[model samples]
Target chain A: MAKKSEPQKASPKSLDVSELMRDNDQPNFLNQMQEDFKKMMIDKQVLQKCIETFLDEIIDQLTLGIIFDLHRKFKTKAYCLEVKENEEEADAEQSEELPLSPVKSSPQKCVCPNCAQQVAALRFARHLAKCMGLSNNSRSSRNASRRAATNKEKGASSSSSYSANSDDDNDEDWNPRMNRKKDKSFSPKKKGTPKRSSEPDLAEAINTDTGETDEAKNLRHTRSNSSSPDSLSGSGNITPKKRDKFKKMGKGKERSSASTSLKFD
Target chain B: MSGKPENANGRVSMHLDVNNGLERVTELIETRLIESGWKDRVKLACREAITENNQNVPSVDHLIEVITPKARALVPDAVKRELLHEIEMIFSNIEKGGYTTTLDG
Candidate 1:
């Protein structure tokens, strides 16, 4: 391991440059920097070709080895079945042991490598709101302000003077017609903005008050609205005024009321 | 090719009168066939039979030791030889015609 560590050292200046690239001030600067690095790494085109050819051969050999392994697996089917069974048993054990609540708890780690932000559960809601281009909508003014602060010092390049989306100018200019198509595609002339054809499906509120079955109340007071009867402890939330509305109805009527609007019932 | 029995040309069988009047009539069909210029065809068939499945094809020694006696007991040696040759020819036909290739443009 000590012997392997001999060539591990890199110039500190390169590290400093990489850190600067990650500093968020230069967003598209990473592209130009990578191009420069590639040029420096391969001064000769012939040398680059040779390296690429060597890499391709190595990749070919690796793929051939994998294919051969798969062929052997096909020949012995029993072993593969055993491996599948083992994986299933492992999954069962993990589920039985952990039983994690699906809900987000506390500040979870963000998947983005650089940001490493402590993301609260509300962050998902905020992110969804942002994705709708709600930045200028004023409701999420705080998030928009935060984005502007981070994006303003974004690109130190002279090209930064232009609008933020100017970076996409290359694509827009490549095919001028494409820009028109993109504009048309982005702000699609939604031929028919589907009007909420029905109120319940859109609002997702099945009138639990409708599945009236006095017999069902006698059989099991647990409302068929939710599978887990422990929740929905009270019925005041649905209509606020209606009580024991579904007093007497058949299973079909019960199912219709239960699923009239799946989002909420 | 060895013995020219008197009825060799006319008849496709031969009766060998052995000791104590025990007579054995061997079918001369294969001998007649070999005489009829099918040697090259027979050799080609044997080669193809072997090539078709070298893994399953019995060696000559195994054929003579194990297979020939059984065939001889079931049928006359000469007829058995012809049948074996015919079986080999069938396998040879498959081996020769089964494979194909595409022409490059």
Candidate 2:
């Protein structure tokens, strides 16, 4: 324990600052400081060099990236321009060839008669029907307006004819040419009405009103004249006493025809 | 060395553990770059270079060169230095084992 204590005491005396200063330790301390400075400078230079190299690497990478990006952008732009140019050239060629071709280039379209609008041929019928319906509505509105005007102008005289005229107009809407024929035939009936009030003449008038053709009217007239009770009984197809019954049957047929015509009127 | 004997199995396992650690570090870095939106730009640079050269694989130095600027831009100086140090350490270890790293282009 004494020996350990003696070493401790000796260590303190060896570290005496005044004694070391008297022996001229100042130069040695300065030299040590200079050496430390040199080492620090060297360390600083090394660190600077490392930082510069890192920065240079970063710059080189950035430059390479920019170069690659520019190259790709230019390549894509050139490709797009080429494609656009090719398309333009194709269009120009087609336009030039169109006039040179022999076939007439009429557009596939039709004109709607009702509206006078040009439409594709495939849709023409549908468009025409729609336009016609529209026109029909307009015509019906016009007719109603005209009826109002005529009612104000001719009041009582026009009322009786108005019903017949409206019916004729509706029939004309379906077949204008047939209505003209009916109008011509109707003129003769108006003239002939005072001349007869017999059954055959009444039947003929009913047939005309029903718009029967001249041939059908003539055939009906021949049948009515030929189908007498005497002729039917002479043929002996039925019993002789049944002649009166046959006459009654002919009258029934005429009545039925009259009823059908009345229904139509 | 203090805890266990330096056997062949131990050496192989250490190497595998180091490789796994390096892979995880790389994944973390990639995730950071993607989050920063720099991954696509780096990948584009690498892709263009690879395609122009008609290369199937890129050198590690080339990949680092293409990615370093973007990495520097996205990461702080201290973090960038730490990341570079980690990458250097991984490369040094791989070199020490005489292993070559192959990256697909």
What DockQ does each candidate score versus the true complex, computed on alpha carbons? 0.00, 0.03
- Candidate 2 per-residue lDDT, tens place, A157-176, comes to 46667667555444433343
What's model 1's lDDT at A222? 51
Clashes of 2: 0
lDDT of 1 by residue, B1-105 (tens): 111122211101111111111111112333443464443343333334334654554345433343323322333345444544543333234234531121111
The residue-level lDDT of candidate 1 at A137 comes to 51
Residue-pair clash count for candidate 1: 10
Per residue, candidate 1 scores C-alpha lDDT tens digits across A22-104 of 44544543354334333423454433343333322322333333334433443455435866899999999998767465443
How much is A159 displaced in model 2, in angstroms? 30
What is the alpha-carbon lDDT for the whole of candidate 2? 0.46
TM-score against native, each model: 0.16, 0.24
